[model samples]
Structure formats: structure tokens, C-alpha cells
Target: MKRMKKVAALLLAVVMLASTAACSSDKSWAAKNDSLTVPIGSYIYELYAAYYSASSQTGDTAAGSASSQAAESSVLDRKIDGKDAKTWIREKALNSTKSLFVIDRKMKDLKLTLTDAEKASIKTNTDSSWANYKSTLEGYGIAESSYQLAAAEYSAKYQKVFQATYGKSGAKAVPDDELKSFFEKNYTDFSYVLCKLYKTDSSGNYSASFTDSEKKKAEAEFNDYASKISAGTMTLQQAADAYKSVDSTISVQNDTANLKTNLQGYPDDLVKLLDGMKAGETKAAEISSGYLYILATKNDIAKKTADEMKTDDGRNNLLADYKGQEFSDEISKEADSISGVTINEKAIDSYDPSMFAAEK
Candidate 1:
């Protein structure tokens, strides 16, 4: 009778162990939609990315270098746009997951597949990342396969959808003449030599002060450079070299091709000047609140050949200026439209961003 009791007890223990294992398996999934189960590891990977991205945006120096506990605390203690950092990060990660789902669904709908070259690139990138962060990721309970899955979503699937929607041969390809016209109107190829009239501290913080003599000297010197460039007496590079020789503190940025309208880091006055100036014409002006004097020469790429407009660089600029926002909005809309998806809050809540903190 005692032997029978022992056997029964052992059987009960086995059943309990199996039940616990099943629960763990369920918890391993972060979300589910119909037959699809999104792994907790995948969500965790996205969370890790979102945390670091937010950290970088907020200029948190300890973001990628801090200890796991410190990293976690840093994000948790902060607020982004009036939202708690933890909540913000979690929402960002989940939204990224939804985007991945959209990418996958769109790729299927479009009958798109990654080329062999694209597949190879993804593998190479994933292998490198996995090798570098394997230990940290494993500690955070992220498997290599999960990381690869996320990487593929971003690198391959997303890009394929974008190309299918907007490539030269895509259904929604912009007309060549329209792209050319947009390029001509909004893009400029130019070079400039800037003589800053302000003083800066050791940390390069500019102070808006220049003596009358200093301003006069800068204006005269820059105007001479501009006249020489306009007369073809010196190339833009030569002028830059000459200016640097005369005033080592002067800033010269030549060969600035394909400058778009209202580009950051360029003064509004300079953009306006470029707009009015013809190709091969050189002009000197005071810009940046009269703190900078510039000698600028516009290049003759305002009217490029049709083939030139079809180059990779040209296409990229168009995407950045035109179709990129449209694509992003479309993806966001698609992600929002996905239905029957449910989050495993229990699983997600159990994970933490600090678990994948960078190793010191």
C-alpha cells in the first residue's frame, strides 16, 4: 500500500511539472494574432532598440554604457513628451512590432521577395550583430533567431515593400518629368567659403561680436575671393585653400553638391542667395545675423540629364524630400488597420529593458 502511494505521488509530480512547462511556453509569447504568435524575445528586442533610441534622443550619456540596473532606472525615471519613459518605450516597441506585421502582410500581398543579394546582406548584418551582442541579448532572454527575425523585418521586408510601392517600376512611380521638375526647383549644387565674424570659446560656442575693423577686413577678403571665382581666375577649391591660408580660423566647405532647399546648418539668407544666383555666378553676402560672411558659387546641376536624375543619389534625394513621408504614413496606417491582434501583457510586463543593457 505504501508502494502504491509512492507511485501515485510521483505521477502527480510529473503532471504538475508538465503543467508548469506549458505555462512557461505560453508566457514565452508576447502577442498573438490568429495562428501567429509573436515571441516575447522579439518584443524584448524591439524594447531594447526603443530604449536606446529614446536615450540617444534625450541625450542620455549613460544610455549604451551604463550597467543594466542603471540603464533600466535611467529610462524608467525619465519622461518623454509628458509620457513616462517606460510606458513610452513599451508603446514604441509594440508599435514597431505592429509595423513588422504590416510589412510582412504587405510583402505577401505584393508578392515581394528579397533578392539573393539582399538576403545575404541581411544574414551578414544579423550575424555581426548577434556575435557582438549575443551575451547581453541571451541574458535578456532574446534568442538569436528572434533578433534575426526583427532585423529581417526592418532590413528586408520593409525595404521590399517600399520599393514595390515607389521604385522606378513601381505601380505608384512618379513621372520622370515631375521628379526632374521637383529636383530642379528644390535642389542646388553649390559651394561656399564662410568667414565667421563672431568669436567662439574653446568649446566652439559662438558669441555675436566682431569689431568694425574685423568685419570690414572679412568683407573685403571674401569679396575678393568671390570676384576671383566669378572671373574663373581660381577654382572653388583654390579659393578655399587661399582663404584658409590667409585666415586659418575661416570655415570653407566646397563641393557641396545637391544642396536641398532650407537644408539645416545653412543660413536662410544663404539659401535665398543661392535661389537668386545663376550657375557659375559667385556672390558675397553677410549671413547668420551678420555673424558670418560667405562667398558662394552655384554649380550647373540645376538641369541634369534624364539619366543623371535616375542615379542612385538622385533617387535617394527624391525619396527623402518627397515619397519617404508618404511611405511612412502608409505603413503607420497599415499597422493600425491590423485587427484581432492581442498583447500578452503578462509576458511583456515580466521583461525589462535593463536586462539588455550594454556591458561595461
Candidate 2:
């Protein structure tokens, strides 16, 4: 998970930079006509275009066109694929726009009550934050104020989330009995795994991209290990060690969870892969992270008195995180349903740089 987190952080940085750039081109639009403005979704596309244009500035759309075409190339080659790459990128762009809008909406609910010193400390710690935003916006060929407005929008959304969850009326609704049951059912078992996955080449790098043949080979290896354990021929540790010796692209680590806060929407295959298995069981086949393998172990389960679990202190300090996550998921679904939203696909399709007349 930590390794996955490292990848996530990098992706987040890229996304933030991209988002900032996309939101920063309002001034360019303004130059053409003082009253000119893009519709909501179109603004998102223009922002995305500016960001990509900044990264690959050939002054022509040729670079963006070529890159998008390559993502589609795998489909033409008969690789197991769905959707054209350009369409995929566009969808992602739209989803991103919606997400940003959601975030800003959430922010509008929260209040960041920080002391004077803490506020000052932000500059010392985050001096480069705005500069970074500015640079990214500039690179994406967007205007500075456009990016600033995007930032403000996101900030508003976050405020809303905080306010909605814990403002005036307060969001303290998770019951004592419910929290205790959740904790008991989801105790951490100090389990560990040593895993190896197939990659394109001999060099060991776990990439999201892999050939089908390589994927099969990796799955075959994990399956053989699981079979041996199931048959009682090889111990889980022994299997882990043996697999490690053969596969250089392997990682070993321990995992423990006191509460399954973020486990929702996780593929059932993954849950079952870890479920009901004792510390020494290896799973058959890989469900995720290429080829999956686990040397399961149970951690010590803490037993607390009913009163201890039911106290206000317990709910607030102990199980607050889990409760918050549960509430977030529930509220998000409700919001989606109430919004009665359908995407404007035609608007997205009609987006063209030529629509914006040139500056005088």
C-alpha cells in the first residue's frame, strides 16, 4: 500500500499541476472579447488543453493529436482494449472537472480556523505552493488569474465539506453500538505478504503497463505457490522465499488495519483473497498488483469493556475516522442522486480553439 501511495502522490502532483493549468486560461479568452467566457464543461476542456499545450508546445495541436492517437493505437492492434484513447482522455477530463467542482463545493462547508502564527507558518512551509501553481498554469498556456480562481473554487469546496460534516448543527451521529461492532468485525491481523508480478522486461519495475503474456506468467507462478500451500506440500513462508528467489520484481511487507474505513468499493476478489485466511495461508492467483501473493498472519486483537467502547471519548478519538468515511460515502451518493445530473456530451464535442477569435 505504501508503494501504491508513492505512485499516488506522484500522480496527484501531476494532476494538481494539470488542473491548475487548465483553470488558468481565462485571461486569454478575455483578450478576444471582454465578455467572452466558456460554459462550465467547455472551460474544463480549454483548461485541460492549455495544460497539455504547455507540456507539448508545438504551437500546433499536432502533439496533442499524436499523443492521443497512440493511446488508441493498442485498440487497432487487437490488444484487449475498449474505447478510443482520445475518448478515454476526454472522459477523464470531464470526470476531473466534476471532481474539482465537487471539491470546491465541499470546501465551502468547512472553516479553517487557524491561529495567527499558524497562518504565518503556512508561507514559510508553503512558499513555493503559489509559485508552483503559477508556473504550472503558465506552462499549460493559461492565464494566472484563471489558475487562482480555480484554487479559490477548490478551497471553497473543501470548506463546504468541513462545514457540512461538522459545522453549526454538528455531524456527530455515529452510534456507540455501531462503532463497537465495526471495530470488532474489522480488527487488524498483523498479516504480511511477499509478492512478485511479471513485467515487460527482466528489469524489476511494477508498472501499470504489462504484456498479456507477462501477466499470465506472473499469475501462473502465484497459482503454483497457492496450490502447494493448499495441498500442505509447502509452508507459506517457504513458498514466499522460493518465489522471491526466482522473481526479482517482488515486494514483501506487512499490513494491519484497526478499522476498514477505506475498504468500500474494493473489489470483492481482493477482499476474499484476504478474508477468512489464517496467518500462514497463500492465496491462489493474483487479484491485484499484477500477481498477488500473501503469507497471512493474525495480529493481537484488543478487547475493551462495553463502557470503554461506548464512551464519548472512545467514539470521538477511537472510531471517528471510520464513522467519517462511512458518512462521506453515504452523503456523496445522496448528493449525486439529488443533483439529477446528466453530462453535456455535445457541448464537449463542439469545443474548438477556432471558436475563440484572435486577440487584436
Candidate 3:
């Protein structure tokens, strides 16, 4: 996850420069022609990462047919549910690009207040994350003050948006009980293995992309991996370690996510696949041609009823997760209303999503 982010920082400075990042917005974005402009700012760092990740994972699934081709070679092979790769990546990029702008604008529009501590923490986290890749950032001409300011206000901005929608009390603070209730109703704690399939050469370079034959072979490999988990021969971590070889492409990572069933945050195919799945079930799901060998360590049980949610002290800690989703949806909705949010197609086209792929 952090790998793509490092690659993104390098791309944004070179590819997402202001001259290309400034694009025109359509109706909801601008009521009058040229009245509203979406400019390139520090936000591109976030958007670039999102677009890159989405494009890599989704591939060309978005195209009407698997063979659908775009002139831009960058996305010629990628998909997002059969949609065009460029189309999908651009949409994701646009959302990340517009998120901060809308959040800050709405904060002013609603006159929300941020507590002093919240302000300080945002800055602190932003500075820390930035420092990890400070050289890459500065190489791209990102000023420390600019990066810090964007990083610092991140929490405060989103908190304001979430509070507005959830109807929080203190300037926009959500009541703990109601927040807990939302959590109890929304999320399920689960862990999964994201098995990204590829064919590796001796040099550890991903040589063969997922083709029809590769997909079948990859499925077999993942099935065996799943069998190991079911038989208790290996845990997910051990499985990840067990299969890593010089010429294998089935890279594994064990991840835990408190996923939401009702939200359309990820692909619908993914959400539906997990529905009613029980713990101890090792299921395989293919996204595009690659595989997601889902060994569900937990499942989405029943959501808490109104009263049950209020009294569910066990899950109160999940409030942050629900709040975060609500905030993201709000920003997405705001972007949706805008008829036009133009990206520099030429600039966007120039980017190669494979830069994040396994290198030799």
C-alpha cells in the first residue's frame, strides 16, 4: 500500500504540475461558463495515489469488452469493471483532486469550528508522513509550508464535513452514543489475503501479465493457498512467505479491514461476494483477471437494530470508521453534482500506471 504512495509522490511533482492540473468544471462545478475553476494544489498527491491504485487493481474491466483499447498506451491494458481505464482512473483522480477543495469550501460555507487539538494533530500527522518522503516531495518543488498546511488541515476539514451530515454537536462534534450506533449498524471486522497474481522471471520481474492461461494457473495456485489455510497447514502470513519464489507471481499480503456492507465505496462485485460469508470460509474472488483469495477470518454478521446499536458498547470504537466513510461519500456527492471536472487528458494520458508494478 505504501509502495504505490512513494511512486505517487514522484509522479505528482513531475506529471501533476499546476499547468496541467488546472482543468475546467462542468455544471455543478461551475454554474456559469468559466465561473468556477478547479486548480492543481497539494491535493494532487492524494488524487494521483488513488488513481494509480485504482487503475492497477481494476485493470481494463471497465471496458465493454476485455479487448477494448484506448489510444493512450498507459491505460490500454487496464480496466475498472469493463469501463475504460483512462475513464476510471480520471474519475478517481478527479474525486481526490476535488475532495480537499470542497471540504474547505464547505467548512467556510457552514462556518464550522475546529478544536485546537484537532488542528495540531492534523499538522503533526501530515508533517510526519511527508517527512518520510520529504526528499521526493522537495524534488517536485513542494514547499514544506504548503505540504504541512495541506496535511495539517486534513482532519479538521473532513471532520467538519462529517459533522455537518451526521448532525454533530460541538461546532460539528458527533455524540459518542450516536456515533457508536452508526458503527454498530455499519461495519464488520474481517481479515483477508489479497493475492495479486503474476508470472515472475528469474530476476523477480513480473514477466507475464494475467492472460487466459495465466488466470487459470493463478486460480489453481490460489486454490492451493486457500486449501493450506483451510487445512491449517499455513496461516495467511506463512502462506505469503511460503509461496514467495524467484519465478512466481502470486504475491500475498494479509490485511484486516472493518468493511461496510451498505456503502458503495469499493466495487459492488467485492461487496456482494462477502455478503453472508462466515468465518473459516476460504473463498476465491477474481478482480479483473487477478485473484483475491478471501480466507475470511470474520464475516458481516447482522447489523445492530436501533436499540441494539445504542447499547452495543463492544463496537463503539468503530465510530471513526463510519465517520470517515460518511465524509468521503459527502465529498463524492459534491463532485457528482458538478457536470464538468475536466482533467488534462494529454497530461493524464502520459502517466503509466505500470510504474507501480513489480520491477526487475
Estimated TM-score per prediction? 0.71, 0.41, 0.44
In terms of lDDT, model 1 sits at 0.76
27-79 per-residue lDDT for model 1 (tens digits): 78887776567788898889988888878766676765646567656766788
**What does candidate 2's lDDT look like per residue over 158-274, in tens digits?**
434544564334575455566667665675444445454434454555565546776566557667766776688876566667776666444445544553443445445556656
lDDT-based ranking: 1, 3, 2
Better of 1 and 2 by TM-score: 1
Residue 346, model 2: Cα distance from true site in angstroms? 19
| lDDT, candidate 2, at 218 | 57
For residues 219-298, could you state the per-residue lDDT of candidate 3 as single tens digits? Answer: 67767877777787876666656556622443443333345544436445556666556646666667533433343344
Superposed by TM-score, candidate 1 places the C-alpha of residue 231 at a distance from the truth, in angstroms, of 5.6
lDDT winner: 1
User: What value does the lDDT take at residue 132 in candidate 3?
Assistant: 85
